[model samples]
Target: MFKLLKYADKYKFYAFLCPVLMIGEVVFELLIPQVMANIVETIRLTDTADAAVQSAAVNDIFLYGGKMLILALCSLFCGSLAARIGSIAGMGFGASLRLGLMEKIQTFSFSNIDRFSTASLITRMTTDVNTVQNTFLMLVRGFFRAPIMLITALVICIRKSPDIAKVFAVALPIIILFLAIFAPIAIKRFRAMLKKFDGFNASIQENFTNIRVVKAFVRTDYEKEKFKKSNDALTAAAIHAEKIMVLGEPALILLMYFTITAIVIIATKSIAEQTLDVGEFTAIFTYAFQILTSFLFTIMILVQVFMAEASAKRIGEVLYETPDIKDPENPEETVSDGSIEFKNVSFSYGKGSDVIKNVSFKINSGEMVGIMGATGSSKSSLVQLIPRLYDATSGEVLVGGKNVKDYSVYGLREAVSMVLQKNVLFSGTIADNLRWGDKNATDEELKNACEIADALSFVESFPDGFNTDLGQGGVNVSGGQKQRLCIARAILKKPKILILDDSTSAVDTATDARIRASLRRLAPNTTKIIIAQRISSVSDCDKIIILDGGSISDIGTHEELLSRSEIYRDIYEAQQKGCDDFDSVGGAS
Candidate 1:
């Protein structure tokens, strides 16, 4: 936890002022009891005296009372100031910690992100960070005030009567032992509680992200049950932790009451024997409360610390996580062209077996290449290598005659624009979402790119045209429309290499053909790589590669593959039969 404090270095002045001012508050508080003792002793001495003596006694009472009031006011002022400073320091630390965590997450490669679940990351950034911030505020204020106040009050009590102070020696150890034994149990429970929180968050996130599927399947009851299970687990864990923490309060209170009773009995005997004065006895009792109350405050602070300990560890994990992929010491600033080569490239998603094994391929600049594979054949994995999303496990992937590792990650990614199979779009107007590819693109550029993707006609048919809003995940658009918009967005990049990973699968055949034609006309020099399930999508490409079981089985033009490659021939025949069946059904209807 202390290691994370470096983020708060900029707020050192406020951090320091908080504790220093708290010490002032404690000093004033300690003086108040002493002043009250003086006032009590003066009154006792003046009892049954002459009128003048009584008058003098009244003046002494006023004097001591005034001193007590001043001390109290000073203490109040100092405490309020300390609280303000502590709040500033604590809030500033949280802001810094959040920024640091977010920046670290942004640097993570795909592999790094896969190591931590999205729900867990969200909990660490929000709930865990909040716990640490609240704990920091408590430490700056109560952590300092308790110990200093305890020591000062203890010293004064011992000075008044050593015998009575010995009672604390007995009570203090019992309190310490109780905390030592139970605090760990509570901390362990808190840790378990945080894990439950992660589960709960995961359940909610999954349900909401797939709400459409859930409702379509009429499985809302199942989702509710899943969420309830997670919610119940979290509640159970929190209750268990709170039960253990609550035990401390009652035990402390019992010990405090017992000690106070002992002190009162002992002080009565001393006063009767003339060994301790009435005024001195009163002050000892006041000091005893102060000391024990400080101890009670300390215990509460320790409880908060234990709660934050789990959060601190979670936050530290994110901050200290190293990205598996990093830029070189001196990286190339530019990719010369879109030419790409994979030399014996193999990759594993951390499993022992490679998903893409001993794969070797080459595509010259300006060539249209198509990748064909069955499900789980690692076709998408192959194209992802071009952008360096995940590094090859064993061999080199080269872009523009240079190893991908030699180029800066940002520069390499900027040069290769990919429309992923998922076709995600942020919540924004059509023009805004397209601008993600090139922020400075003009309205004409957006329209031109949309036209190239065969999206302009539909876009213009809407009353809002390019200004139409796309709700979250483009929920407002049809699947085919979403795919075209994503393609348009990618086209606006004017990248050196363009990859479409089943991006046109949702569109009709004629629309898909028009899109392919537009790409050839508008980006004749850009290297195009297309991955598709339909053989028609890739039959027109300059060359096609077939993957089977993580290895390339054949490579050739469409007609050459139909003659020699069994897999390509089989797929083409199957797609032709499906289209014929669809046409027959339409005619009969």
Candidate 2:
């Protein structure tokens, strides 16, 4: 909690001003009761005096009455100002905390992000940070005022009315005991509730992000049932966590009323016995209310403190986390060329067995290469290491003749463009999405790249052409069109190396052939690596690498692999047989 508080240091001036003004308000508020007492005493005594004496007493009463009004106004002004300043400080701190969290998240490596998961990180940044922010505001607003008012008012009561003071002494300890017992229990419950919140967010995110899949499968009822379970669990946890606060607040309020009842009886008896005056009793009642109300505020502050403590711990975990991947000191700034080599590299996700086991391969600069493997062959894992997305567990991966760790991440990734297996397009116009590759790319460059990707004809057909909006996740376009657009975006980078990881799977074979031919012709100087399931997709590559069970089974040209590698020959024969069957069905139809 203390560690996260440093984000608030930037607003320390506003924080300082808030407490000072609060103190001023408390002081003026305390003085108002004394003036009220003077007015009441003067009015009560005037009844027994002579006419001139009564007239003089009336002036004293007016004087004290004006003083009370002035004191009340001063307190009100100071309180209002304090509230405004406190908001500035609190809101500034919240903004800084969210920004800081985002900045830290951006620095995290892929593995680090996987450790926390996307949904949990979102909960910590939004919900947990909000909890800590609200608590900080409460602390700043009441940290000094509550305790000062409680202590100051209690001392006055003790001096003037020992009986009433004694009642508070007992009541204060009772509230403290209640807090000591219930607070720890509430904190533990709220922490459990936060975990439920993480699960709840994950459920909603998965449901929304994959709504198309859900609808296609006709699983609306099943999804609704799943959501209901998650929602019910969250609600139960929240209710259980809040039970202590709900029950405790009313009990504390009842204590306040009970103390009021006791004081009323005692003060009334004192007045009837001629031991206390009307003026003194009125003043004592007002002071008692202040003292008790401050205690209530104090209790509320303490409750928030306990709850925020849990939130603070979650937030600190992210902020203090060390990224598993980082740039080295004196990092290389240039990639030089597109050549890549993996030297006996082995990698596992965590403590699991190696998915890329002792693999060694190299691709020459500006050469067209292909990787073919069955499902779960760690194909994506192998390519990700080139950009240092995740470092090798054992051996070195060299890019452009320098070890990948030697280059800054930005510098390394800038020279390599990859269109992932899952083609993604944000909600934007066609031109806007394409600009992600090269923000300053000219209109001609966009058209040229789109042409090479076989996307130019469809894009120009849209009513708005380049300005046509893609909608959310490019839902406005077909899967093949989305893949083409993603390919176009990557090509616009004009990178030294470009990787297509099963990116052409959605397109027809004719369109895929056209795209490959265009790439070979237009991007002749650029190194190309294609990972595909279809044998025809990589048949013309300079060399084809086939991965079998996390090892390189064979590396050769299409003709060379057909004669030498049994694994490659089998996969090629299967794909050719499937294609021949598809043609026969078409001929019959």
Candidate 3:
């Protein structure tokens, strides 16, 4: 837990002031008992004195009472200052830690992100960070205050009555032993609770993200049951952890009452025998309460520390995770052209069998190439390597005649614009979302890119046109519209290499053909690689590669593939028959 304190370095001054001010408060608190004792002793001595002596005793009582009041006010002021400083320091530390965690996540490659679940990361950033923040506040305030106050009060009590103070020596160790034995159990339970929290968050994220699918399938009841199971598991874990923590409170209370009873019984005997004065006895009794109370506070703080320890471990895992992909010490700053080559490239998600095995291919700059493959043919995985989203497990992937790893990640990615299979858009105006590809793109540039993607007509028809707000994840738009917008955004980059990974799958065949035609005219020099399931989508390409499983089954033009490749011929025949059937139905109607 202490290893993570480096993030709080900026707030060191505030952290330092908290403990110092708390110590000042403890000093004032220690003096209050002595002042009260002085007032009591004065009253006792003046009980049988002359009138003048009694009058003087009244003055002494007033003097001591005023001193006690002032001490209390000073203590309150110091404590308030400490609490204010502690809050600032603790909150600032949390903010810094969260920012640091987010920054680290941004640097992670796709594989690194895959190592941790989205729900787990969210839990660490929020719940785990909050736990650590509260623990820091307790450390700066109660942790210091309790021990300082306890030691000061204990010393005063011992000075007043040595025999009575002996009770603490025995009681303190017993309390410590009790906490020592139970703390590990609580920590383990808290860790388990955090895991449950991850499960609960995962359920919520999954259900919300796929709400349309759930509703479409009429599986609301099933989703509800799934969520209830996750929620119940979290509740059970929380209760199990709290039950152990709850045990500490009752045990502490019992020990406190027992210690106070022992002190009172012993002090009563001492007072009756005149071995301990009434004034001194009263002071000792107050000190006994103060000492035990501080001990109790310390134990509570320790319990929180144990819980925070679990949080710290979870947070540390993210902060310390190194990205699997990183640029070399001296990387090339420029990409020569869009030419790409994959030589015997093989990759696996983990230690499993290779998804793409010994695959080799090359595409020249300024050429239009099409990739046809079945589901799970590793088409998307193959293109992702060009942007270094995931590095090849074996062999080399070269872009622009240079090994991809040789070029800086940012520079290489800038030259390659890819519209992935999954289209995502942020909550913003249509113009804002388009500007993600080129932040400085002007109105004309945006219009031209949208025109090429065949999205301008629909965008202009909207009431607000380009200024129209796209709700979160572009939920307000149809799937085809979202795909077109993503394509337009990619087009705005005007990259050397443009990859459309089934990006036009949602659009009608005619619209898809129009978009491809616009791309040929507008970006004649840019290398284009289109991955499509529909054979007509790639029939006119300069070259067509048919991927079977993970390997390229055949590579040729449409005419050559139709005569030589069985898989390509079969897919082409199926799509052609479907189109003919649709035409015949239209004629009959």
Candidate 4:
């Protein structure tokens, strides 16, 4: 947690002021006991004395009472200011921490994000940051005030009467012992509780994201059961962690009461023996309470710190993480052409076996190519390399006759537009979503792109035309409309290479064919690579590539592949017979 304090550098002035003002409050509190002692002594001196003496004592009481009032108001003023400053610093630190984490997450590649679950990251950003923020507040407000009050009060008690101060010798050790015994167990339990929190958040996210599927399949009961299990586990873990704090609280409170009772008994004996005066005894009680209360408060703060330590560690892990992919020392600023080649490239998600193994292929500039393979053939993985989304494990992926890594990641991706099978749209107007491909695009450009993707017709059919709002995830639009809009968004980029990864599956064959034909007409100089299950979709391509077991089985025109490649022939024959299951013909790849 201390490591993250760099975020508070911007609020250093407020952080410094919090403890200083808290100490001012402690000073006023400490002085109040002395004023009370003075009032008690004056009363003792005047009891049963002459009227003049009693009158003087009353005056002294009034003077001392006024002083106490002023001191208390000063303390209140300082404390209120300190609290405000502490909150400013703590909340500011949290804001900076969250911003820093988000910025780091943005720089992360797909593989880097894979290392952490989305739910866990969300918990770290929210719950973990809040815990640490609260701890920061405690430290700034009480770090100096508690220790100074405790030590100063104890010293005053000892100097006035050593015997009475001995009561603390018994109390301090017990508090220390309690902290030692409960702290380690509490840390481990809190860590477990945070993990349970992650699971609970994950359950909520998955359930809500796929609520439509659950309702469609009538699996709400199963989802409810799953959610209940997560909720129960979170509750159990929270109780397990809090039980230690609960058990320790009353034990320490009881110890404090016993210690105070012992002090009263000892002070009464001293007064009877004429060694302690009434005023002095009264002062001892005040100082003793301060000492005990400060000590107890310190222990509570320590417990909070221990529990927050778990959250701190989780947050630190992401802040210190290094991305697996990084830009080169000097990278190419632009791609030269639409030409692409893969030279013995292989890739795996992590340390697992390569899903794409030593595969080699090439596509000429301005060529419309189709890639067909059975399920698990790593079709998406192969194209991801071209944009440097995931670096090839071995060999090189070249775009525009240069290694993809030679270009800046942003530069490379800007030139290659890929529409994944599960493309999504944000909650916005139709024009708002299309402008994502080119934010400065004109009204005419949007219509042109949408027309090329066969989306303009339906988009205009709406009452608002291109201004129609698509609900969250484009829920208001049909799946085919979403796909076409995504294609239109890609087309707006006017990228050198366009990849549609089974993106047309939601649209009918006629619509798909229209999209392909429009691409050939409007984007003649651009390289187009299409991945599809239907042979008819790729039958008109300039060349077709067949993938089997992560290796190239054949590369030729559609007619040549049907004659030369047995797998391609099988898939074609299966499709011609109205069969869509490629695995039944092409087998496992």
Which tens-of-lDDT digit does each residue in 1-589 have in candidate 4?
A: 8899999999999999999999999999999999999999998867855898899999999999999999999999999999999999999999999999999999888898999999889999999999999999998999888999999999999999999988889889977987788788888888899999999999998889889999999999999999999999999999998998799778878888999899999999999999999898889899999998898778778878988988999999999999877889899989999999999998899889999989888899899999999988988888888887789999989999999988988898899999986789999999999999999999999999999999999998899998898988889998888899999999999999999999887777778888999999999999999999888789999999898888888899988998899999998887777575542333211
lDDT of 3: 0.90
Global CA lDDT of candidate 2, please? 0.90
The residue pairs found clashing in candidate 2 are: none
Report, for every candidate in turn, its global Cα lDDT versus the true structure.
Answer: 0.91, 0.90, 0.90, 0.91
Q: For each of the candidates, give the backbone clash count.
A: 0, 0, 0, 0
- Residue-wise C-alpha lDDT for candidate 1, range 381-479, written one tens digit per residue: 899888998999989999999999999998898899999887699999999999999999999999999999999999998899999999998888888
Clashing pairs in 3: none
Off by over 4 Å in 2: 269-275, 579-589
Task: Write one digit per residue (lDDT tens) for candidate 2, span 163-193.
Answer: 8788887888987888788778888898889
CA error at residue 252 for candidate 3, angstroms: 1.7
lDDT for 438 (candidate 2) = 95
Q: Kindly list the per-residue Cα lDDT of model 3 for residues 1-589, writing each as its tens digit.
A: 9999999999999999999999999999888888888989999868865988889999999999999999999999999999999999999999999999999999999999999988889999999999999999899888788998998899888888998999998999998998888888888898899889989999998889889999999999999999999999999999998998799779878988888888998899998989998888878888999999998888878888888988999999999999888889999988999899999999888677888889898899988999998899989988898999999999999999999999888899889999999869999999999999999999999999999999999999999999999998888788888999999999999899999999987777778888999999999989999999888679999999888888889999999999999999889888777853443233210
Give candidate 4 misplaced runs (Cα > 4 Å). 580-589
